[model samples]
Target: MGKIVLSTNVTLDGVVQDPDGQEGFELGGWFHQFVGSGDLEAWTAAETEEAQGAEALLLGRRSYEWFASRTPSMADRVSSTWADSMNSLPKYVVSSTLDHPRWRNTTVLNGDAAKEISELKRKVDGQILVYGSYQLVRTLIDHNLADELRLVVFPVVLGTGLRLFGETCRRKPLRLVDTRRVGDGLVSHAYEFVSVNPV
Candidate 1:
């Protein structure tokens, strides 16, 4: 089965909202503001490398829309460059409302997220990466489906915003497999689920 990986950019307080400042949120651009110049370059390089290695990309509805709007010109660029790197690696967007994908090599998933992911894992080789989809990540976590987490933790805390994890969720112990300081002050960490108590 392919490894299911959750990768995200999060703040010190766990906020994962628009790090790029395009979302119209007052704090949407916190990443560029807080991340040190040196750290930013390292983080980008690391992320670019990770994206190049993904066999498939999984995204939530909101993330899909955001990506679609932000990089329309890069849609073909993505397909030709990184998108073409894998074995016809497709993108699966989980949504109840979206009826079709607007980009090539993209599919809309309307069924149970867990079941769909299980089927995909059975069919694919290498790793499937989930990026910047908090809601989907939460569901994957709840179902004990996520195999690994790659988090780039920034130094600044957005006093309020959407969080990567919620307080209501049960705690699951994670085994830290790797850690490194990238660019300026950003800390990159990789953790695997050690034990999961099914909800």
Candidate 2:
């Protein structure tokens, strides 16, 4: 069975909003500001390891559009394994509203997102990676579909914004399987979902 891995970058306070300041969120550029503070080589290596295991990319509509619009440009500018993996991987976008996806190796999945992901899990071998698709990740969490979650935590705290684990998120118990230090104050925590019994 293919694993559904949820990967993300967040502030210390758990904010996962527009880190690049592209979406009009006032606290958008926190991630970029702190880029030089950490061990960039370790962080980049972690990302490359992640891409090396993924079979395809799974994203929400907005994320799909964001990556679709930006990643190809990145591929044109950079010659790296991470860029190559991102630009070449098959990507499935979960959205009811997005009709056409023009990105190379892109497919739009319109239906119950969790169900579609479940079906995809059965068909693919390797990991189905999700990045910056917090809402969809929440759905997968609520439905108990996510296998692993990796969070690259930056040290700064954004006082307010869209958090990775929001108020609406279902409470889940996760096992910390691994941890690694990224750039300066950045750390990556890899967790595996586990069943929790009600007290």
Candidate 3:
């Protein structure tokens, strides 16, 4: 069975919005803030390692479009290696409206999202990576479909933004599998969701 691994970069305050400053958020570019501060290289290496280890990519419609739009320009960037791994991996996107995906080796899951994802978990072996799909991640966690979380935490408090976990999210316990510093200021934490039977 394939494990659903939700991977993302987040601030110390748990904000996951616009890390690269691409979406024009007010406190965007928290990722780039560590570039010259001796963290970017290590962070990039860690991200690359994660990407290379993933068996497949799962994303939401907006994130799929975002990555597709940036794919052409990613070849020459510092993230080129990671981008290469992403582009080469099989991609699954959950969207009712997306009829055709421009990204190569892409599958559009237009049917019931939860059902399709559940079926996918049974069919695919190894890890199925989810990145920046906030809504999708919430749905997985709420439905008890997500298996693990790989968070690369940056040392910054934005005070407010789109957080990874929302207020109405149900209580789910997680077991810390690993925690380590990626760079001078960045920390990587891995957590697995613990199964709990209700009374």
Candidate 4:
């Protein structure tokens, strides 16, 4: 079965909103604060590695639109290799109202998201990577459909923004599979599900 990998960038305080600050959130550009610290090589390398392993992408509506509209224009950027993979990979977007996706190799799924994802897991060969789709990630987690969760935590406290986890999320336990310093102030945490859960 293919593994569902939920990966996203987060602040030290658990904010996951607008890392690039392009989304108009007040603290949107929090992740960009560390850009010129001379540690981007490690950061970009880690990102490239993940993109290399992903077989396909499973994105929510917002993330799909956000990435689809921007990634194609980044082929000449510093991490063009990663951008190429993102643009070329087959993508499945979970949306009920979205239509006319301009991104090639894109499809919209409007049925029961969890059931559809479980079916996808049984068919795909490699990882179904989920990026910056917090709502969909939470749904996958709540349904126990996510096989892995990889969080790259940046050293920042946004105090308030869209968080990685919702307040009413189920108490699912995770086993830390790996932890690494991806960069000077960035830590990557890899986690898998644990049988123990709150009763």
Candidate 5:
């Protein structure tokens, strides 16, 4: 079975809102503040490594639109190697409204989200990285579909914003499998979902 890995960048407070300040959120751009503060090269290398390791990408409708609109080629702002990996990877988007996706090697899952994703996990091989899909991540957690979480935590507290876990999220157990420091304060935590009913 393929592993569903949620890989996302968030603030120390778990805020996943606009990190690039493009969304006009009051507490936006927390991610950019770490540019010169820490070891940027190390962070970039870490991100690139993750992108290269991922076999495919899974995203929600909004995240797909956001990334498509911002970085069409997936190259401009990101490293060429990382961008290349991202552009070449097979992408699956869970959406009820999207009729056609412009991104290459893309598939739209418009049916029942949980069932489609579960089937996807069974079909696909290797790691399927889920990025910046808040609602989808919650659904995965709620349904016990997510197998692992790789969170790159930035050192900042955005007080209030769209957090990773909302009120709709249910209780789920996670076991910390790995932890790595990217830069000065950026810490990456990899947690494996602990199955309540083990098979």
Candidate 6:
């Protein structure tokens, strides 16, 4: 079975939105503005490396839109670098209104996320990676579908914005598998689901 790994760049307060001044949330970009210069490069390299090993990519509509708009010219470049290396890895976008994906090797899924991911895990040989889609990640967590989480926490606080982990979510216990300092001062923490204890 394949693992569903949720990787995100978060703040000290766990905010994950627009770390790179791309989200247009006005207060969105935080990490990039504050973190050390080398941190960003190191972080991206690590993420790209993880993504290269994935058999498929799962994204939320917002993330899909962001990438589609931002990397229009780099479609081929992205595919060749990341998608092609993974044998043209497929992408599943979770959205209700997205009729079709403009990007190649992409599919729009409008169904039970947990069931779909569970089925995908049974069939795929490599990992299924989820990046920068907090909504989808939350759903996966709520459904207990996420197997692991890779968080690169930057040393800054946005004070407000979309958080990586919302306050309404039920507490989920995780086992810290690894921790390392990447880039300048950014800390990367890898955690696996240990158990879903009742609150």
Write candidate 3's Cα lDDT for 56-160 as tens digits.
Answer: 999999999998888757878767898899889999999999998999989999999999999999989989999999999999999999999999888889998
- Residue-level lDDT of model 6, residues 4-71, one tens digit each, is 99988888998887777865888766765777767766765776688677888888999877766655
**Which regions of candidate 2 are displaced past 4 Å?**
76-79, 168-170, 197-199
Per-candidate TM equals 0.87, 0.92, 0.94, 0.93, 0.93, 0.86
Q: Which residue pairs in model 6 clash with each other? A: none
Scored by lDDT, the top model is 3
* Candidates 1 and 4, the one with greater TM-score: 4
Candidate 4 clashing pairs?
none
| For every candidate, C-alpha RMSD to the true structure in Å | 3.1, 1.9, 1.4, 1.7, 2.0, 2.8
User: Per-residue lDDT for 1-199 in model 2, tens only?
Assistant: 8899999998889889988888899879877787772456667777888887899999998898888887777754543878888888999999888877888898888987778889999988989999988889888888888899999988797799988886544578889999977866788999999987768
Query: After superposition, which runs of candidate 4 have C-alpha atoms over 4 Å from their true positions?
Result: 196-199
Candidate 4: Cα lDDT at 169:
53
Error of 6 at 155 (Å): 1.1
Better by TM-score, candidate 6 or 5: 5
Clashes of 2: 5
Residue 192 of model 6: what lDDT?
98
* lDDT, residue 105, candidate 4: 90
Q: In candidate 6, how many clashes are counted?
A: 0
Q: Write the per-residue lDDT of candidate 1 for residues 1-199, one digit (tens) a residue.
A: 8898999989888889889898888889987788776776577568668878888888899987776664446545433343334324578899989986786678888988889988888888988999888889988887778899998998887799888886536777889999998875888999998775466
lDDT of each candidate versus the true structure: 0.81, 0.85, 0.90, 0.86, 0.86, 0.79
Report the CA-based lDDT of candidate 1 relative to the real structure: 0.81
In model 1, what are the clashing residue pairs, if there are any? Answer: 38-183, 38-184, 39-183, 39-184
